[model samples]
Target: MNRDQMEGNWKQFTGKAKEQWGKLTDDDLDTVAGKREQLEGKIQERYGKTKDEAKQEVDNWFDRNGW
Candidate 1:
């Protein structure tokens, strides 16, 4: 989803986010709070991905979910 949409529906998306990235803790999601940059950072941190890789992954996810 786009950043504004994500922030608006953060609660609804949290479960899906956990499913997609099981390594992320509830605290991580809370900290991210639907911010795209934070989510990208978390993904990079937890997945050992480069920043560009994380950004592309997030973009692909948004596309896949039709967000």
Candidate 2:
């Protein structure tokens, strides 16, 4: 899904996101609120990933999920 679609459907994706990134807390996902940049930031913070790594991971997740 695109950014707006992801944001719109965030509640639905949160479960899968948690599945993929188990280190993230509910509070972190809530803070993300489906904004891609925020999601990337949270991934970076929780996973100690660089910006590019987080972005790439999100891209891969999006491609796999296609939601």
Which lDDT values do the candidates have, in the order given?
0.93, 0.94
- For each candidate in turn, the TM-score is 0.93, 0.95
Candidate number of the best lDDT: 2
Runs in model 2 with CA error above 4 Å? none
Candidate 1's residue-wise lDDT over 1-67, tens digit each?
5678899999998998999999999999999999999999999999999999999988988888889
lDDT per residue (tens digit) for residues 1-67 in model 2: 6778888999999999999999999999999999999999999999999999999999999989865
List clashing residue pairs in candidate 1.
none
Query: Which parts of model 1 have CA positions greater than 4 angstroms off?
Result: none
